[model samples]
Target: MAAKDLSTMYGLSESDPEQKLINRAGMSASDLEQIDRIMAEMGRMRQIERRIMRSSQEFMKLNETDMRALRKIISAKHAGRSVTPGELSQYLGISSASVTKMIDRLEAHGHVLRTKHPTDRRSQCVEVTEETHLAARDQVGRHHAKRFEAASRLSSEERDVVIKFLAGTSDAMESSLGSPLDDDAR
Candidate 1:
C-alpha cells in the first residue's frame, strides 16, 4: 500500500522540537505516538532496573561494582568455569589494583573466597561463598528468571519482532556513539 501523505497535519505542538522533523519526514501523528509510547516504556524499564540495583546494593551492603562482580562470579560458577582476579579486572574494565581492593572487600565481608587455581599455580580463582551464592540465587536470580515467563508468552513471530526492534535500537545507539557499548560485557 502507498504510504499515507502526512505533509500537512503533523500533530506535534509548536514548541516541540520534533514537530518540524516529523512533518518534513512525512510521519503521521500515530507513528510519533507509537514512538513516544515505546520511549516511555523503555524509561519505565530503566527506572525499575535502577530501583532493583539500588535495593540489591543496600541489602547486600555492597556497591554497584561489587554486586556486578558477584553476579559475574555466580554466572561463571554456574557455567562450570572459574573466575580469576585478572579476568575480573578485565571484565570490570578496571585495573588489577582496583580488582584486588574490591576482592579484599568482598572477602572481608565473607561474600567471596580466594582459592588457588586447580591447574594454574600462578593464578587464583574467585568464588562466591555458599551464603552469597544462595542469597543471589534467591534474590537477583529469581528476579531475572521472571523475565523468561514474559518471553515464553510471546508467539515466535512476536518474539522475533521484539528481538529485531531491540537489536535495531541498540545498533542505533551504538552508531550514534561511534562505538559499540560494552560489546564483551554483555
Candidate 2:
C-alpha cells in the first residue's frame, strides 16, 4: 500500500502535533482504536503479572525491591549469564552501595551466595542458591511457562512479526522516556 494509504489506516492527520509524522504520512480512526485496544490488553497482562509477583513476594516475605533484585538474578541465570553487584546496580538504576546492601540482605536470608568471578579476580558474582532457585521457579515459573506455551502456538511468521513489534514498541517507549525498561526496576 502507498504510505498515504497506510497512514490513513492508522488515524494520523495534520492537526496532531504529537503524531505529526504519522499525521503527515493518514491514520484511520479505526486503526488507532485497534492499537489502543491492543495496548489496553497489554496493560491488563501487566496487572496479572504484578498480582502473581505479589503473591510470590508474600510467600518469600520480601518487599518489592528485594523481589525485583532476586528476579534480576534469576533472569540472568536463566540466560546463562552471571550477574555482578555492579550489573545489578545498573539494572536497578541505583548506586553500587545500595546494591551491596540488597545483596547482603539476600545472602543473610540464605537466598543468594557470593563467589569469586570465574575470570575476574577483583570482582564477584552473585548466585541464587538451589533451594531459593526452586522456590522462585515455583512462585512464578508457571505463568512464564504458560506464556512460552502460548508463544509456541504461533506460526513462525506470526511470531516474527510479534517479536519485531514488541521490540519496536519497547524501543520507541524507551526513546521517548529516556529510560530503559521504564519502571521495570521496581
Query: lDDT winner among the candidates?
Result: 1
TM-score to true structure, per model: 0.86, 0.71
Show the colliding residue pairs in model 1.
Answer: none
* Model 1 TM-score (2 dp): 0.86
lDDT (C-alpha, whole model) for all candidates: 0.81, 0.79
- Residues 17-61, candidate 1, lDDT per residue (tens digit)? 654544437767688766665665676677788998788788889
Candidate 2 lDDT, tens digit per residue, 1-186?
A: 222222232332323548645542365667766665565567667778889989999988788878878888888889998989998898778899998998899999999999899899999999999988999889878788999998999999999999998888878877998865634532
Q: TM-score for candidate 2, please give it.
A: 0.71
